[model samples]
Target chain A: MPFVTFLDYAGVAVFAATGALAASRKELDIIGFLFLASVTGIGGGTFRDLILGIPVFWVINRDYVWICASVAVLVFLTAHRFESRYKLLLWLDAVGISAFSVMGAAKGLVVTGSVSVAIITGMLTATFGGILRDLLAGEPSVLLRPEIYVTATLIGAAVYTGADIAGLAPLLASILGFVAAFIVRGGALRFGWTFPAYKGRPGRHPDDIP
Target chain B: MPFVTFLDYAGVAVFAATGALAASRKELDIIGFLFLASVTGIGGGTFRDLILGIPVFWVINRDYVWICASVAVLVFLTAHRFESRYKLLLWLDAVGISAFSVMGAAKGLVVTGSVSVAIITGMLTATFGGILRDLLAGEPSVLLRPEIYVTATLIGAAVYTGADIAGLAPLLASILGFVAAFIVRGGALRFGWTFPAYKGRPGRHPDDIP
Candidate 1:
């Protein structure tokens, strides 16, 4: 349980860093960095807890907010030192996603005793934060992109849920899920892996065809 | 109480229509239209309930989902016939925001006896759905616009909260709030009222100055 808590904190910190990097790209002020970081760090878990009808984790404990705010401040002071902040953001986001996917599924299983819901919570926890970040930053959403981001989270969540259902040890199952997600997301980052984007055909609309 | 319930349903329907209009502009499929409409319709209330640690209203009732889905389908069928869909969308959005602002504040007051929380929840309920709609549709978010959108919601919420604190009747307070929000929003739609946007100053970076 302590290890899982550590993973959660690490995921939040890394996600906050990515949000701060995005704020920097937008030339936002310090308040903007703090807002984006806090939102991206907590958005996914908040969504999961809401769906599960549980008290929000951050509201019960304020440490998460402090962690996100601290990371935002650190990133604001030092982000300019990076040669390619975008590259750093991608790497950090991969780590955050892998960590959150396992932790979210574990929490869901404990709360709901349902495998399918656990898998979904895992996916939501891993991806919703980044979605909110992009929305607030006015950047393209990862959901709309061709990249293999969501697929990676889905695979991770499924593997974790399956392992848990098969009675694997908790830590082992978490490791398996984290590794699965990281491998897929890392591959996409390194090799530009992508699914084919939808293309509109020139044919008449279905409702329009007489 | 029944009137409040009616207001909630009407707000959801109007918000869903705006979301479907956005999906049509994006040339999305039927599934996409349904998804966007449902998200935009129930999103703000979901946020409110989650923060209040109450059961999500839609998950409990299910009628909200039906209303949103029905509105989406209806708009999808007849939207093309409108000569100025954008104008129609704006008017409907004004109505939706106004109703939601009052309802959100009232719910917040009932759940938590804190006036500040009530005002904040009201603002969230009124604006968050439209923000999500714009983000998903890849349109510039109303938050990024100079329009008096959030201001209208804030004012409406504050007025409602104040009236309730002054021992006004619930129905009367709600009407006052809704009318206040609608008048401001409607004015913005009819005549281009906007706050001045922030302008970046040309100066040396604060951290870089020696």
Candidate 2:
């Protein structure tokens, strides 16, 4: 299998595990774990495919679904074995997002031939799954955080698309994209790097209003 | 335009208005209103198209986007005019969902040629937009409610698809579907109809668990 394809599957597996863990927090049934896992792992890519007017990746290929189900079941059974599981999960999730972002941009570039749209596709592909997961779990979404999460995806997409446009090999451009996203996300995870929240009068906290 | 086409646009308009109202509650800016409105109007249909491996509706026809944006701007400017706006909004949303469910199933049949898949497409098309709206607005999702929201959509979809399969005329079948969904939702709205929650011993409330 090609390297990019391998990274896609690996990213999906780790993301599925994260979804299963989140489902456990809500005391959802076994079916919920499977459902959440499948959605979370592929949600971003599904959105990307839809916007690009292509067949969703997992529809024609059931292997992705099997991988997600396997990861979810594994997480469900052995969740208690690992200490500091949530922390580890976050780092793994960062890796998954990076992989997804690069792949998403590459796909977008191929489909649309527009770097700006491709960059947005990368950001959406990186973040939308976790957004869907939090929504399903009824938790506050990471999008609400004043973090550099989406920005990292943007940087990765832009770098990759720029390099590709500069006539670099697809493999090298993809590696650069993945490395850029991983570095930014790692900084955020390890050093708590975040963007400043909007503090203007119109952007007042909802609680402060009522 | 065909009657079904008109219902689709009407549904999109009303749903977009509801999304704008939701955004206003969070004090989101005008741009937020537009974003939420667009998502709320077409979110379900987009999912349906994606799953059926068809091109998304809005991307091909910019008219849908224009309608959603127009509704959002109208709602954002006049949200405070009514004293019981949310109550009115719920009734309007019910109408939109009913219309969307019928049309979605009809389109699904055209694309997938399976009544069962079409029924599911109807349900997703009716409820998913509101679900997306609530998630983006950081509010408690309607899916968590015991009320007959999704059930109403399911009823409409099943009724319509069944009628269509029974050789009913397309327009009549669609009308039956819309009426069925609207009645259930309207009844729930007026009488506070809801389902009983499962009160399992081991699966107690999350707050009560710890």
DockQ for each numbered candidate: 0.09, 0.10
lDDT of each: 0.84, 0.80
Q: Where in model 2 is the C-alpha error above 4 Å?
A: A1-43, A50-123, A126-139, A142-210, B194-203, B206-210
Chain B TM-score of all predictions, in order? 0.92, 0.93
For all candidates, the clash counts are: 0, 0
Top model number, lDDT: 1
* lDDT by residue for model 2 (B37-84), tens: 877998888888887888777656668878988988887777766555
Q: Model 1 — TM-score against the truth?
A: 0.60
lDDT of 1 by residue, A55-156 (tens): 777756668878998999898888877766667877898999998998888899999999889989999999999998888877667676556898888888
Interface RMSD of each: 7.6, 6.5
Task: State which candidate has the highest TM-score.
Answer: 2
- Give a tens-digit lDDT track for model 1, residues B96-170: 999899889989888777676677678879988998899789877765444567767877888889999999888
- How much lDDT does candidate 2 score? 0.80
TM-score of chain A of each: 0.91, 0.92
| TM-score for each model | 0.60, 0.61
